[model samples]
Target: MSLLEKQPNTSSEFEVDSQRRHEQDAHLDSKLRTLRLLDGARAGATLLALLMGLAVLGTTGHALQAYNTSRFDASAGGAAWLSMWPDNGAFDVKPTVALVVGASLVVLSNVIALTSHHRFVRARLAAAHTPLTFSAPFVGLVVAIVAVILFYVANQSATADTLLSWSCRWRFLNTASPAPQFASLCRASHAGVDLAILLIPVEFAAFVLAGFELKLQRYTAAYTHARKTPSPVLA
Candidate 1:
């Protein structure tokens, strides 16, 4: 072919290549935008879950304290620690059920947050970006799981047994004053109380971590999009 004729063909091929590249870049940009939106949504959902879990934990703590107080009053007259009292109105049943239900709900919330976070990571990877390694939602999930287990154990066991000894006040009542036994039980119960208290901060930390992750994800996605797109010049 003559040089002049070959020139047109070469220019046409170059145009086709440039057009294809532009189209590919546009496609990538669209996908990245979709991912950014998804990540934002996942992050929001995670935050909501964390908050709900915290509320549940707080309720569980309050319920447990109420139960312990009622138990102490019932055992005051040298009554058997295990002796059922009507003063509390089915105390064991109500607190136990509330705590178990609360734990279950907390666990469910963590599971939901975890699943959303996993999806967020996958979306980031698909967009050719490094997924977040550590996040608040993940930390919150871990703390929530631990809290659930601790609360379950605390609620199921009768705190009174640890605090007071079962005895017939008329027989061998002086053998061992319930005082020492009650003290020891109180100490043990306090340990669980301390654990429940610790969860508050842990849960808060998890929520903070999730918030940071959400912000970072949003920032990174915005920066990436900005870098990929060409700036339009004013004529």
Candidate 2:
């Protein structure tokens, strides 16, 4: 009777151990899935920033070209009222170039980070907790600031008493109107500015999301490490 009871007890102990291991595996799977979702979100935000940056570059390039090609017909009577020269400051492409460079760096950094996610998490797990030294957030911040400057420049160019404003005002006028000469250029500049404004928020979100993802990774690593570590032995 004693031997039969002992055999049943041994089988019950094995069943409990198997159940514990299954639970642990399930928990680990859940954590991995969560991490994947976060990484995906970070990637999405970064890609959007890249697209917006490219768009700004295109619109600004067009504006710059249009401005250079614009000519004034002093023969027209309204030529006295219309300025042939567009606002040089407003149409400058240098700022747009800077914005694009920053955005490209952000995308490249994100790619590198995604590829190294597993290794990064593993390192975090093995090492003591430390602050992240990633530069994505800082780059994103700079990009956002540049975008703001672009927006301000564009807004001022569009609204101020500049040639761009003049062109827009007379855009619907007759074909003989001198405004037509500057209209297209001004429109491109306005479009570029609008895109830059949009970029501000997008860039901010991208960096913010990246920062959040880092925190999540750190937390996950620490949790995993804690679980793997054995408890202190009792005296």
Candidate 3:
């Protein structure tokens, strides 16, 4: 064959090979991007779970402290107790606020993580020739259950002492000790603490299960993307 004639054929073959290489590179890049997104989603899920666990622990601790404080006041000279009534109300207020704020943070973190996981799953399904489903709704259901338990604990009723005692009257310059009212309040506090102890474990389990669901979604996306791409490294 003439050199000029053969040169055209060689150039055509080289162009085809270059195009194939470019397509393969693009596919590999896409796979890498999907995997990175999955990793990020999984990390976010883990962080959310940890935050929820900590919040549960904090709330439980607060409940226990309140219970102990109430019992102490009931046993002491009623009004003489540091935890009694108006004297140290601020101390109780601070812990309650902390519990609320921590719970709020946990809910926000989980929601963000769930949204990120859904995005990652959708992206993978679009790029790959596979059927994948993400179950964020189940996680939301579990969160709702936890919220209900928290609400129940927060709204329980309390009664305080209102009896008349000479010491309480002298201390507060009043005619009553309010010991009966204080005792009732302490009983309510103890009830709340018991309820909290029962609910915290359930909440912790829900958090862990949600984390597992997120991790499963992440791994599924990573695996499906690797399978579709013609790359041995990812495979």
Could you estimate the TM-score for every candidate? Answer: 0.42, 0.62, 0.37
How many clashes would you count in candidate 3? Answer: 10
Span of ten consecutive residues with least summed lDDT in model 2: 125-134
lDDT of 3 by residue, 1-235 (tens): 5998999999999999899778867876775666566555544544545454354545444544554555566667445544334434222333333334444544554554444446666575553312111233234335434554554444442422211121123343322343324333334434433433443454455444445545655665676567578766664
Clashing pairs in 1: 136-209, 136-210, 162-185, 163-182
Looking at model 1, which ten-residue stretch has the lowest summed lDDT? 162-171
Global Cα lDDT for candidate 1: 0.50
Model 1, span 111-230: residue lDDT tens: 555554566756756443323323434555565555546545545565432111221112233324332233333333344345445545555554665555556667666766776898
Residue 208, model 3: Cα distance from true site in angstroms:
15
lDDT of 2 by residue, 23-118 (tens): 887987887787778667766766676676667667666654454444434434446534544354544345444544554554455444444445
> In what order do the candidates fall by TM-score, top score first?
2, 1, 3
Candidates in order have lDDT scores of 0.50, 0.59, 0.46
Q: Give the top-scoring candidate (lDDT).
A: 2
Greater-lDDT candidate between 1 and 3: 1
Pairs in steric clash, model 3: 159-185, 160-181, 160-182, 161-178, 161-180, 161-181, 161-182, 162-178, 162-181, 163-178
